[model samples]
Target: MTISMDQQQTLGLSPNTLKGVHHIALNVKDMATSRHFYGAVLGLHELTGDEVPETLVTLVAQGKVANFRLPDGTILDLFGEPDLDAPHADPKQQFTRANHMAFDIAPELFDQAVAMLHQQQVPIDHGPVSRPTGRGIYFYDPDGFLLEIRCDP
Candidate 1:
């Protein structure tokens, strides 16, 4: 049996309507630190109040939020909720990378990104290792969330 476009949409499996991820939201312990890391260290542009939509402001009024735009226009939202607990990933577990975010960078800039991570004193948890896709450097955010910078080439 085959599924029609209308059937796919009805079942919420329509890839045509789903372009890509618009944003990723993370609960952060310290808003200022996370903001600086994403804004200053990672060099993502944080959206100002004027840049954020009024609808979003009203929706997330319970906690402070910092919106950072990736190069491709994807937004990373940091929600300020210090009390929220983050689950630690056990190295022995197969799902160590079960909840991580990866960012793409040019192959040539890979070295610079590694250097920047070091200059910022962010310890690399793993690679700068080669994979079928590309080289990647894994590190953690200030809130202990795993993050990776992979070469797009």
Candidate 2:
């Protein structure tokens, strides 16, 4: 099966207005650690997750599994206490390390993100360098996961 979506903003007709992704979820070793990297360091809004435990979170404490909404319909989810590496039986395990995810943020928002990362003492990688598609900033999460933040083309 194949699905096609063109980034078109339609006002009427059997129209289609497709944007970016809705969300992306990742695994972590610990909930608190994940929260620190994603919520504290990255400035993502801390929200309550009903399924998440309450003992470890007190409005300020690092909590499990949270979401960060990018400018587009892109949402980033950081989950915890799950497997970090692939199963040992998988033959393709050696080739999966290249996987990564990117977020679409406005240029102004990118500036704010840079400032926020600096405040958190988080190191940034490459620039707000201009690309044919958009401006982007590359950085690593607390777990050394590469993340790219870009804006509209």
Residue range 1-153, candidate 1, lDDT tens digits: 897978755553223322444456677878889888989999999877677745467544554877788998987877777775545555454422224566766677678778777866786899889855567788999978878777644
Tens digit per residue, CA lDDT, model 2, 28-147 = 556667667767787765545553224224422444456565444455666554556555567656533322466666555666656665665666887768765566667788878767
Runs in model 1 lying further than 4 Å from the true structure: 1-12, 58-63, 89-153
TM-score, predicted candidate 2 vs. hidden true structure: 0.38
Q: After superposition, how far is residue 104 of candidate 1 from its true place, in Å?
A: 20
Best by lDDT: 1
In model 1, the worst 10-residue window by lDDT is 12-21
- The TM-score of candidate 1 is 0.47
What overall lDDT goes with each candidate model?
Answer: 0.70, 0.56
